[model samples]
Target chain A: MKIRIFVTLKNGVLDPQGKAIHHALESLDFKGVNDVRAGKLIELDVDDGTSDSDIEKMCEKLLANTVIENFEIERPTDQAAREA
Target chain B: MKIRIFVTLKNGVLDPQGKAIHHALESLDFKGVNDVRAGKLIELDVDDGTSDSDIEKMCEKLLANTVIENFEIERPTDQAAREA
Candidate 1:
């Protein structure tokens, strides 16, 4: 299975990277961008039988820093097609 | 409007970060893992009128390194409900 994990900063956390991107966009003359938040996308190719709890455990153990970040896991349906 | 940009390393690229994560997972005793790839997620809160072409330009010029990275843009429908 191909699993995708998105780890984003908590709402109140300061994101310097996002601010840098926003500033760079302005410097490039791009307008109307109100806010920007940067996060991580980790794609894992695991065995088909990998359980959801195991994946969540992976996240809790290593993939995410639960203190200031939140993560969401997605199992894309297209993975089956890709593997076929 | 809210737009999500997923930036990932292209195939054949050497991702030390992903390798490190995979190694760490192994260290944590997680099994059945095949591969891991790390990427970036950038969330943009832009004006409702921001054009898709404009967003694409942002990716091409600054958000992604076209030579080694691929980026996908998604406009989540839930943004409407979130803004409500």
Candidate 2:
């Protein structure tokens, strides 16, 4: 199964990369950008039988640093139908 | 309005970061992992009136390197209803 994991910094955590992007956008003359945050989108191709807990373990063990990062897992079965 | 932009390497492009992640998973004894790809997720807080073309411009000009990467833009209006 295909799984997607989004790892984002928790609120109140400092994000220097995000701040840099925000500055770059301003220099490019793109207006009205209130804020910018950067995160990770990891795509994994795992076996269909991989259990939920196993995926969670992956996140907790390696994919995310629990202290300042939050992860959200999207299983193939949970994905909403996309519009082509 | 909130907008999400996902930037991923084009097919056939090398991803060293992804390879490192895959190797780490194996060392940790996680199995059934077929492939892994790493990408960037950028979240922006922009004006509600920002036009689609403007967002596209942002991606083309700064967010993504069109030669080796592809970017997908998701507007708040395009999001599917979530279960919460």
List interface RMSDs for the candidates, in order: 5.0, 1.5
**Runs in model 2 lying further than 4 Å from the true structure:** A78-84, B80-84
Question: Residue-wise lDDT of candidate 2 within A1-84, one digit each (tens)?
Answer: 889888999999999999999999999999999999999999999999999899999999999999999998887654553322
Q: How many Å off is the CA of B77 in candidate 2?
A: 3.4
The RMSD (Cα, Å) of candidate 2 is: 1.5
List A-chain TM-scores for all predictions.
0.90, 0.92
Please give the lDDT score at residue A2 for candidate 2. 88
Q: TM-score (0 to 1) of chain B, per candidate?
A: 0.90, 0.92
**Number of the top lDDT candidate:** 1
CAPRI grade, predicted model 2: medium
Go through the candidates in order and give the C-alpha RMSD of each one to the true structure. 3.9, 1.5
| Cα displacement (Å) at residue A56, model 2 | 1.0
Residues B29-64 of candidate 1: C-alpha lDDT, one tens digit per residue:
999999999999999999999999999999999999
lDDT of 2 by residue, B1-84 (tens): 889888999999999999999999999999999899999999999999999999999999999999999999877755553223
